[model samples]
Target: MAKRQPKLVLAPAQGIPFNLLVLSQSNVRRVKNGVTIDDLAVDIERRGLLQGLSVRPLLDAGGQDTGTFHVPAGGRRFRALEILVKRNRLAPDAVIPCVVKPADGDVSAEEDSYAENAFREPLHPLDEFRGMQQLVDQGGKIEDVAARFHVTPAVVRQRLKLACVSPVLHEIYAADGMTLEQLMAFTVSDDHARQEQVWELIQSHHNQSAHFIRARLNESTVPARDPRALFVGIDTYVAGGGCVVRDLFEEDRGGWLQDAALLDRLVLEKLGAEADRIRAEGWKWVEAAIDLPYGYHHGLRPIEATHTPPTEAKLAEVATLQAEAEALENEWSGADEIPDEIDARVNALDERIAELAGGSWNYDPAEMAMAGVFVTIERNGELSVDPGWVRAEDEPVVESEPHGEGEGAQREDGVDGDHRQPGLAPESGEDEVQTEEEDEGIKPLPDRLISELTAERTLALQDAIAGNPQVAFAAVLHNLVLATFYYGRAESCLMVTLTKVGFGFQPSGMKDSPAAVAIEARHAMWKERLPESDRDLWDALQMLDANEQAELFAHCAAYSVNALYEVAPKYDNGRISAHTVERRLVHSHVLARAVGLDMVASGWKPTADNFFGKVTKARIIAAVTEGKGGETAALIDHLKKPDMAREAERLMDGAGWLPEPLRTPELPAQADLLEAPATSELPAFLAEPDVSGDEEPMAIAAE
Candidate 1:
């Protein structure tokens, strides 16, 4: 028999030693049977032992001090202390405090150890799976994740594999009965692509006993090729395919069987006959139905036999029938039924026509008389009325005094013939101003004369600009400015005036004179007013070389129609000389400088030559064309240089000033220069008056 170990009693202390009883006593034995002392050491290292080892006092046979404690459990802790002492990490003589609980009546150490480990550090498969999956979700390697969680990489891989599984299966796994190893095996061969086969197999095996399922699985490593194979020898087929077929097919077998048996006979005989009959008679029936009104009773009639051989007689009969049917249709055209509303409308129209004819005899009589005249002319080919009764003949013809041989009624041998009235001619040295009363009592100007005049001016301006190169540029620029400022009326009016002035000066040979220059300057000012987004304006601006742009800006700034208005008072006294007008140019220059500043501030590039060149070009063009002589081609060609062509085209097209080819003549090269003499006299108009009241009234001699 093995001898029993003695026990020892130790007093509890207020302060516990970090290492007590590190050395193992002689009676102490190491833990055995699959328990490692290192585990207890690990536990103590993680959570220091709250309750120390319990032991009982031991007595020798003679009552001597035999130092040994009978430790029921915590033999592992005692062994760990012994190992720590051997390693010199713990003191060999230090005593550790402990609660001495009874081992026999209280809970066993095994149960206590289990309770402590279970509550203190429980293991959960789902928690482990979640932690591992989290690492994988965050881009961590499977191996690293497994290492971090102290799990096998394959286990982590399997858990991550669940991500691809159906939610239903995931729920099943979460129910806790499933093992990872089992789930992995189930999923390994289960390809979602083959789901149809797998599902069918599953359905076949559902409600089957476990033994049956196992047998099926064993019989086929792969799922069944035909899922129905799994259901063979199973009573489920009777409830499934058989029952469904029986329910659907049992009652309807007769028709189906008949159809199958007599298909050829029906198609060849009955179907063929019916199709032929329909083709022949269907058209006739359709025609009859269309001819008859809805709900009208047409007695039942048998269809006539179809004629196989066509003949003229048959065609004639068909035509006769068609004509008869058409006659019947014509007879029914509101003949038997006249709606009250339609009748009332017809009567109303007739009444209105009669009333109109009855109330106004003038138009009717005129029409009837004209018609009678036409009939008479057609019958006799001439009117035999008395000349005195003819109003046109009865009207008096006034005679004028005959003038010089060539001016008076001469031989009617001229190209246009003598359109002069008989015995009417201006006297020698006398200008003929035909009085309106002599003609037909001078026709009064119509009420819309002003409006017509304005329209004519606008049309004339457009025509002048379109036909003349010089006017085109100014016109386009003015219009652009007008559109920008929303001052259409002023712009249009100015355009008309400019065109007229241009026309008047063209014949006078002042086309390229100071007046023309001033007009061009005004146009440039107008161009400056164009909105920034206007494509034509931008193109025009871009066409200017740096210096030219600056010059244009400077010229426009120095000279403005508005500025002229401001300075007009200085010249209002009248008789202001050319010298005075020239002096005002200095003020114009100052205004130009101010304009330049504004232009620069508005983000327009400052260029002297560009500003002056544009003004110069516009003035020269306007002067040369003078709203005549068809100078648009030369101007457009000159302006068609790459920089200005697109903008010039847009302006010309938008303004409807594009001239048709060959409609007008080309301008002479000296046209602009010819205008200088007339324009040189402009300063006289700007001269101040002799306000001292000594000015003489200009006299005019009457012819």
Candidate 2:
């Protein structure tokens, strides 16, 4: 400072004619990078070159000034201006903004260029989003902003979607508390409260993966791919005032409908209208249901219907379609693979041909008088109208009530109340036209879905009875009392009965469960003490004390606990429609509750292979989120399903997690544990940008 800083002389700011400014070799940006020359030119043309080029005077050996200038830094800018001059948009002699430097070696053109290129830091995504949001808030059209920024409107839309997420989430995202992918998932739902709720729910969970976040956000809503939503078209759903939350960042498959009940209502209304229209075609009764039970036609009669024959015009159309199909098949038969367009065309044609070939069915009025129609949605969201079903009560009554005393009842001729549907022969058995799966409709609960439930349930029920002799005494007393006092109505309960449901059908790992081990040990102990022969069983049992007899009785009675859930028969499909099954579930749960059947205490804990692996990734995340906090659940959300399941199993161990079937009606004390943590209304960045637009900004930054 004492030396008086050398009188500083800086580069002169001046304008050079476009023709005089030539790009210099010292520009270090050799590799092609962000912002194409064309785009830069457009931006310059639109905004008129915001930055000046760094240039040096071209001089002779004497270091004298020449007319032309050489640009070093801002090579892109120079090229953009040059482009305008070439396109005749700007005159060749147009003055371009630039900083003129001396010909001296005080500063190298390469140094200037390197400084410009090397010092540039890409704008943060959040900053970009904020700027874009600012432009939008200023009433700038999305397209206009995109054009100005040299980005697509879709890109603008995706950035803008970030605004829809809760401010708490935005702050978390800014702090790197959540990943960009997870934030993207939150954009599907615009509800600030819901977004925050989901965040809190996941923050404590081990699995906060993007997929899990999306699933959690869409829990209460129906996905666009759902059968109900698909049955009711998106456009139609929107027209009905239903809100669809679309994810701009991910493949949302369309989006989720926020109003699931509304979609269901629409589907029901549409189905009802179709049912009414079908009923007008002449039928005894018509019903519209969202899901018709599996084997709904059981014990019911069916009538045959004839479809309208094809006319000459229809036949010609069919011939045309068939010819097209054959031509396509021949053309692509030798190819390694057909293009998607060609394949789609072939499939479309096949479907059309099948539709045309099936024609329309005309039912007989006589059969229609007794038969009913049921309209339901098919799995693929297509309309499925099942007609020609006659209920037992609706069947025609044969006057077989003994024409004389000597004449036997209807059963004498191998014909009872079972009346054959009109227009059909006796050989056509019930559900004969249905596939095995269709007939079974939900037969044997989906293997993996209930595998854990079934396995754990059997163990819990058996172990509970074995441990609780008091409940066993009462259960036995209840059964014996009903048999003695209630005569034929001996069917008192689904649980604690004499009937032994085989364990062969139970899922794997059941034999390895604690209850199974304990039962095996107890049975082995009894076997060692008792006589092996059936003849000596009574004497061997009689030799035991009262307590031993009670323990053995409880063990034997425990085998009757069939807590497994199988779809009850809609009608009597052989087994006496235990329609009592639901009541049995209730009664058994009551008995289990009486025995203080705490599944957790009974040693039933969810594991990867038993529970998590058997369920969807979403379920695993949900269970983790439930047992552990959402933050804990969020920890594993990003993992692949198998990995997530394994991790979830680890986190959930000793967490006392129970699947729906294993749980009783009463919820634990932690039901309200999913509430969101207290958070500021908006992030500082978003709020600070607008002082007068809304509320205080420092409320959060202060913390």
Candidate 3:
């Protein structure tokens, strides 16, 4: 195997003489006279130099030893050392051990030197661009130059492009510290002038933040150049690069352009559907109008006809005949009864009178005149006439005319008086008028009842009950009792109102009996069916006082109790078993303690006849006994003196004064001597053999 080459070493700073290191490359040509050794010195002092020179031994043609080495890199560092030395600074003598690679094949030293100068400190873009230009000028392919610095050719082009960009844009780009990527995105145009314009745009906005730059770019009004113009054969603008077109479309369609094409299409489809709906609705209205009854197409129109006046002979004959009929009707109206002579004349003239009248003489003018005269008629059916009648001094006499019996000879003129009689029958229009009048007279009862119930009387009652809670409670009780007993339809409405009032205010009465009753009534009404137990409970409720009833039926309600308890009391009047009452009292006591009400005095007093008395006596007995056999002895010990005992004895004596059956004796002594004896087994009682059996066998045969 080949041995590994020795690794290159670097010089250390400590314990080394400072005057021996070579400072510069004698062979390398200088490009600028302004470049000085002091520049290198300043750089070194500011940032302590981290890298050393790479150099090789220099030889003359004679192959003799020469003291100089050709610098492969670090020319700047060597110059910096020279400056320090001239300024009386001690220089290190350490040989910065280097790999003597062939200089012709290696470009890393140049690239690294440039990179250190460009990046180790911030270099202005102009300076970097100049550096890149020099590198490309020095027989370096742009790619190779770019690759050596670990940058893309595009990036390198941007730096060079920066040289051509407007100074304004360059300053702007530099001020904002924009990335090359951002600048490339902005520089689509190859024209230096256009690129300069864009640069000016970019620079003018340097004072703007990144967000503002993006907004301006988004807002730029310049129309997008044809994609083919921008890039050969390109058919479309590059993604996300189009200028917003604010005025490209009509205002109504402007919003459509803002959305994605697909969304816009969907919106347009919806708009089309809506338009179709509107058109359909419009057409429906048109169709309906066309089909409507009493519409223009179906409406009535006025009729036009020529008029002719009646002949003068006919008018004179009608006037003469009307006057004759009026004279005859006046004569008939004045008569108490139509006289036989006048009746015959009136009947004969009736046909002629009807013909003279336009259509009918069946319409008696006398009847119409009588209707007017009867305006003063009293509702009691008494006819009245105007007293200021003008009486004729001499009445015109009506001539009697004989009737011609032959119908054909009445007139050759086609005249029928009977047709006129039909019009005189009282008009059917009066029937319709009377019907409308009747409907106007009647109203619905429920509406009236509701109105009456809500009147001031009801309101005042409600207010009074509300102000005096006791009245509200009594009202609730009253309503519940009514509901339970009647089971009427209105019971529910009444109970509901009472319950609302009951709950609205606290009961000021002894108990919430009314509230309980209302609750029970509601429950009974709402339940599937009334249970017998509920009926019994109702009966039990009535015997109880308000407090007892309230307490007993509070869960179910006293309405049921009141209904039943009014008839029966013993079982339903909240008279629970002593044990149950005791349990309830104990529970109440426990609850009171738990809720911090234990210290409150119960204010309970007991008498022998009452439930409380029994409970109290039982409690006292239990306490005194306490599983001890000295309860009486305890009581005796508790009464300290003989006189006090005598007083107690007297009270006991008085209690004993009642009938023997009614009196209760003192409790038995603790140590009374009435021990029960142990039961003994008597030899099974043997019955003596009956002599009647003559001699029963006394022993069994041996078996």
Candidate 4:
């Protein structure tokens, strides 16, 4: 093996004077790439030639060696040295390092040049980022590093940020396990724990999109474009000790606010100040909130106000705008599509006219004193002041009762049917005094006893109504009408009342509730079938036969039920008393049974995120005990709350269990009401079946 290796002759190396070296036409490199020769020349002049140029003996036609050398490889270096000589920086006779090769060497000058240019690998981006970061960490200024590398300061800073990614992610990036974009996403958060958590969550998933990673990292943050953030300018936010996180790798729309709680506090503080300022305008009350739920003015009356007339100058300006708009419209009338400038002008004129016309409204002083204003923020981050909203209870009370003759009969309690009163005046003499014992031996029942009796009566009435579904259905319809047309009053046979269900504060996942989904679907279905006009509804209902009516009645009756548990009234002004809520729920259970509601059967199941994850460990265990078995609950009791909740959720799956509110109260079985009950017993209107009689079975099943 040793004998087989041929003797290797290395390329010759020697020093050559700058004057003797000459550029070679055989050099392979022609196109510009990487660093330019001019930049190389500056570098060589500053530091002298770093790499030796490749030179060959300049041979004449007779093959005799010439004293001058022809440079091949590193021609750029030769040119750089030549420029220095031309600038008189380098002496013409200055010694230059050169690698000499025989003119007839085995390796051609072109091959040597090509090898030098194409063999070296460029540095990886991650390596460059890390190198930059190291320089920054070692005390090099970002500006200094950028100047040294011929890059923008922003680019240097971005590279430094990428270097600040979670070390675990950096390792992955270095190993080519993650993309550069994903690594950039991790730079959004400096917290290594959160970065690793988000990475761990999405790493195995196919959807490791950079945007998804950024979104997950910034889930709890407020986008810079959010109305709240816009209202509180970024400068003010930062001045108030808030931070913003930016994505240097992609467009982030000015980035995201890192401190959501601080932003909220600032928003509330500003809104409160604005509210106070508005309150100083002599309004009775000013309700301020970031957002008011849709239909917030329910059960309140909005008084119409007279608009203030515009000033003469403003009127003239409006007239001018109108004239301009008219001219533009006339000029572009025949065009299929209006020009953007003309359209913009028309829109601007319309807005100006509206602003001029929508002057401040004037309300009567008396009405303003009793009315309140809603100080709110609009979607566009502008302040909105809605005035002249009067609650029903706030309206002045009018005397409606007739006066009686005697002093005692005059209702000295200050109002008729009023129970709360001051202690009866102490009589002056024994003859006039009527003590408790001196009065008849009768006393009113205790309030608690009255409540209990009414509770029982409510239960009995619900049971009775359940037996007669026809009356129950009609009562529900009557209640709905009373609620719609006569707010705060009822003339229905049923005492139940359904408050307007406001979209007030929503729980996190309420929109995903199966009950909400079913309700929405049903609403859409009925909306499509209902007549367009209110006047057409009576005829439409008449067209539906008995079976359809019964089905429709059952559906409509569902809305009137008030089974929700509410806070008891601390003050007696509210309609529902503490005991009333309790009794109402108890009666609701009976109604629920009559309707045969089974929430579990209605496509609801316990899940860790939606239900179990939110509750306490004890609640989760209790749910597992109820839905699964006590054994299952015991198995998970030793686990942490989150883990126990998840396990309990899994164990409770497919088990027909429900919370008290959603469960249909179990009732004793009876013969099928549809088959046994006589048709005559049903409502006169519902006695006859539909033409197809298809929905009759549905009505029975619904009951």
> lDDT by residue for model 1 over 538-588, one digit each (tens)?
455556566765554444432223222124332335544334545454455
Best by TM-score: 4
TM-scores, all models, native as reference: 0.20, 0.55, 0.17, 0.59
Candidate 2 regions with alpha-carbon error over 4 angstroms: 1-11, 136-148, 175-177, 306-361, 400-703
Ranking by lDDT: 4, 2, 3, 1
Rate residue 528 of model 4 by lDDT: 70
lDDT of predicted model 4: 0.74
- lDDT of all predictions: 0.40, 0.74, 0.41, 0.74
Determine the C-alpha RMSD for candidate 3 after optimal superposition of all C-alphas: 44.3
Residue pairs with backbone overlap in model 4 = none
lDDT of 2 by residue, 1-703 (tens): 4776788777688878888878898888898888899989888887787888888888767878778888888988888887888898899998888888876767788998899888889877777788899999999999999888878999999999986578788788889887888888888888899888778766656567898788767767888887788788999999999999888987779888999778988998999889889888889899888876443454455677877977778778988999999999999999998999999999999998887877777888998999998788876789988788878788677684352221122445554223333344545553353244355454333223355588889788878987997656655644532322222133444353355454434555454467767877886676567553334444555566778767776765675677665554434556633344555666677788778788898888888767888898888888898899998988888877866776787788888888877877653256444553453232121122435866543311110
RMSD of each: 37.3, 21.7, 44.3, 13.8
Alpha-carbon runs more than 4 Å astray in model 1: 1-71, 77-85, 88-99, 103-124, 131-171, 174-179, 186-703
For candidate 3, the per-residue lDDT at 152 reads 80
